[model samples]
Target: MRLCVEVFNGYRPPAHLRRLARPADAAEVVAQGLVGARRIAELRRPRRPGDRRPKHTTPVAVRRVYLCEPRSGAVEVAVALVTGERTWAMALRLELHQDTWCATTLRLI
Candidate 1:
């Protein structure tokens, strides 16, 4: 989830997080998310002279984690991502494949 926010904030490249997802989903997320994230970063309001916030800070964090094991080798994770501007709810499905967990689906709720 931190990886997703980092990608959204332009702090990390989409490819860095893409490895977590299946190939097709990775490609789709990159095509849809990367470009939009860049634009969103650009549109963010710049800091003003009177603002006291640090120049660099972690603006994203996980507010809560909801995990469910539906079956062996499969789990669903729901989390709330809190950012400076707003909170985003996300759901991810992960499956154990080749002894490694890989994201099968991701949804923004």
Candidate 2:
């Protein structure tokens, strides 16, 4: 079976406080890192927080993804905070390709 890995990182707001910039930003971060059909599937999923209904009323900060191809066998992921309203964060997920199926790495970003 192919090896898989998943990694994630983000800021946790104060108790009861929501991070307005997490959802979109997280998506962008993951997008920048991964490629191929598997990467596309990951982007389609609502992996970011606050990405659900009740869209952001105010223009919350936009988030972005940065991918780095390292010499190691694993993938490197990074998040970029483009706006002042947001900060840098990132998460990663690895999937093992097996018999035309994919297995989750059981990682939370």
Candidate 3:
């Protein structure tokens, strides 16, 4: 989960994760980076002229995480994230590849 937050905050895979992926996965990683960056920008946009910019992001706390069948290597998580007075529901799907976990899905609203 920390890894997910780190990528979302920075919008790119760190060096180690980058090295572990196949070509297609790498492309998705880059695309996700763009999406994450854009989403955060929209979320943190200043509402008024004198307001301060948003701060460095903290990882959204996960309410629950569910593991699928043993060989499936898939995990699903539920997280509620607060944006101002609104609490958004977030769901994520991650898969294990070469013994390392990578996010295969991300959704927030």
Q: Identify the candidate with maximal TM-score.
A: 1
Model 1 lowest lDDT segment of ten: 36-45
Per-residue lDDT, model 2, residue 108, is 21
Tens digits of per-residue lDDT for model 3, 28-60: 554554565467556676789898876754443
Candidate 2: segments with Cα more than 4 A from true spot: 1-56, 59-62, 71-73, 81-84, 99-109
Cα TM-score per model: 0.70, 0.26, 0.55
Please write out the lDDT profile of model 2 over residues 8-83, one tens digit for every residue.
2112212111121134244343334333224323434566786763343222132665555444333444544322
1 against 2, candidate with superior TM-score: 1
TM-score of model number 3? 0.55
Q: What lDDT does each candidate get?
A: 0.72, 0.31, 0.56
Ranking by lDDT: 1, 3, 2
28: Cα error in model 1, Å: 2.8
Clashing pairs in 1: none
Task: Rank all candidate structures by their TM-score, best first, as comma-separated numbers.
Answer: 1, 3, 2
TM-score of 1: 0.70
